[model samples]
Target: MNDKNSTEPTQPQPPKNNVKGAWNQVCGWMQENLFWTVAYVIALLTTVLVGRELFEGDHSATFREWVLFFLATILFFGAVRFVQIFTSCIREDTQKPGQEGESKEHEILKAKELQKIELQKRSWLIFSYSFMLFALFAALLPFVFDVEQRSAAELSKRPIAVFVGCVDYSTDDEAHSREELRCQLVDSAQSPAPGTQAPKPITSLTQQTSETTPKPGEAKTSDTTDTTKTEYAVITNTTKTMPTDTGIKTEVTREITFHRYSKNGMWIINIGGMVNRCNTDIYCVRGGLSVPLYFVILALFGGAISLTRRIPEYQKQAYPKYIQIDEKRPKLQPNQLREYLVFQIVQFISAPFIAVVAYYLVVPESTVVSVTLGFAAGFASETILLMIRAVMDKLNPSTTRSTQFGSISGYIEHNGQPVKDANIRVIGQQGLEAKSDDSGAFVINSVPPGEHVLEIKHTTGTQSKDVRVNSGQATSCHIKL
Candidate 1:
């Protein structure tokens, strides 16, 4: 009994012990690599301040100001690149397999290889993210620092004109040919009147109405020669001719007031369908530091990957005697291809949810119904695909029950926190499968039922576990990696 008890295996200790050490190492690396990050943040803030001054201040650009601007630009780029390189270095060092005591030449060679990989990763990240950041900055800066209004002279230069015509007046007894006139004026052109002074053009027209009648006590008389002369007031049009030779050209001047150095100066830009507005001063001060927030996210991802890499190491340590390797499966069949296609279709359908969220938060005044329609279309397509798959499975029970038909539903995590865009894979007797999305949760359906292996695969490391799935049921699994 004692021998049997001694031979029995004890449960492996949790890697919880390494957490503190790993955190400490990560913090140390961050502190060392973040020198440029700090500088960038400071320079960015300074730029914002200077930009505000430029917008609101009455002072003209001085030689010193130009020099400082040049320096700030340099510092911004420098700090950005430096932090990028430093993070890359740390990522590379963590990925290396050998210990510190390896032969110097071998270590150097490994370092070179690691450096090459880091360079590639950094290049890709910087190229993609920096372009996005710069584009956003370029867009918003103009709106913040510039304010424009139309001048009165410019308004006066707009087309305005007046027209004139004549009409006749009449009473019940006899009609009189009274010349009733109307006048119109236009202000856009030079005054047509015969004077140097320009007159304000009449903007609108009005008419007066009146009636005349004799008293009831007046004796009735016929042809007594009481010819009463009726008078009427009217406006007449006049034309003024210009001398052919005097051709004096008139020019209108418009005034524009621009801020020189105001801290409140703001600019807004909308790019890639994202609308953002910021104070010129604030953007200048913080733009450089903004790049590293993405880096921090990447590093956190890297750390999670690094810690998970130890899983394979620990597997080797714990299961040395039980090691077994399986042969890879053959090429997928038509049905298999369809299954994979359906899964991909579902993933594609879910992608627009992010876009919907982006639109709502970023562009509040946008048509909500249109966005909703797009989302409905995408989601409906996915739902239809799912129904098709379900119907197909129901029609062919054997096919659905086969070892090739399985589903993997799981959440992605980093540092024990859910992380979006983390990829997951499920390896089964039939073949390899994968799925991922922005929400950090994924489901790889149409996989073969029965005992199959699941794995988390990423740039940093891979982890695997065995799970069993019953036909028509999705297998639930949660992997920290």
Candidate 2:
């Protein structure tokens, strides 16, 4: 029987977390959270590509549709994730008030746990509000500033305009009268630069002289014929060239412009559908903030999103829990929370600047799509990262199951002597009560790690001690009264 027992194999334990160097820790973290790492990498790549595309002013409507649809998909995921977390919090809250037949000590512990859960839920609610605000900002960033003011007639024909200039040149010899017409399609802001007529056409005429000798065995010609064609044709899809002693050059220049809409010019030539370019306005819109309206709109969106999540009836009917939670999840540490908050604040502050830079890169040409898409990408990236961190924390088994709870232990003494019947309690944590033994030794179980206030009450008086706790580790403190 001893041999049989010795031969039996024990179950394998989960891997223990070891202290590692910064690089090693990063590697280990990436290895453990490979899914989230891949997701973040993909999001970064997508954001970069989208930003570049926006900056360059990609004109493909299909690409724009694709980006918008991707943002919509991200919103859907964010909403679902928010609903899941919100439902989890609600379930915990609903379960807390229903615990019955428990002793006073156990009830206190339960109540303390519930209070902690409530704090966490409120934090998450604030996080959701932040996300909603970001989304609102992204959605309205293009229209925050008013467009450049223009006359009704200019606005009516603003998409396409023709600046026509006609010049007549007189020459000697045969009294040649050459008529030259210059037509151009310029931006509304770029038109005629205030009180000025169409741009003066820079015209230059060159004369080429050549002499031809007769072929071999033939007589030389005394007179040279000038066979130059002075009449030039201006056609949309045609080219005319003039040959000179220097080289053959095109006489008429044609530029095909791409715009938001096709345009037909009734002038010397038509410069079809050109870019909806901006000039002085920079954004194609006037630069000035309508701060009140913009903030009010964002507030409305945030309030609506908050109310929808907070109302229990709405949560139950609309955002019902689809996934079941079989076990408790790991709670975030204060340090981890600080890191999260810093990261999110950075993202939020940089989001609009990124969009603005992208817009400026494609200035003189409207970058509305780019700014909106870039903003959306930033918002989505932040929201997705938040969701990933929350989900990863929940799925981390070691922190969730083995170290989900902690304990606190210490001694109560006065004048180097044991103080029996000294009651110790964790402030903000009910049911976490302990009485010192004859040796002044006390122990409290089911206490969470991190900062906590410990209050000791005895015949002497009541005193509070601030303490820090670590997961699965015993924290010792001595109180003197």
Query: What overall lDDT goes with each candidate model?
Result: 0.40, 0.46
Query: Candidate 1 on 257-285: residue-level lDDT in tens?
Result: 11111122222111122111111121111
Q: Residue 407's C-alpha lDDT in candidate 1? A: 69
Question: Candidate 2 residues 294-337, lDDT tens each?
Answer: 22233334333333333332122222232323212212233323
Off by over 4 Å in 2: 1-34, 54-91, 94-108, 144-238, 241-481
| Each prediction's number of clashing residue pairs | 32, 8
Highest-TM-score candidate: 2
Error of 1 at 332 (Å): 29
Query: To one decimal, what is the Cα RMSD in angstroms of model 1 from the true structure?
Result: 26.7
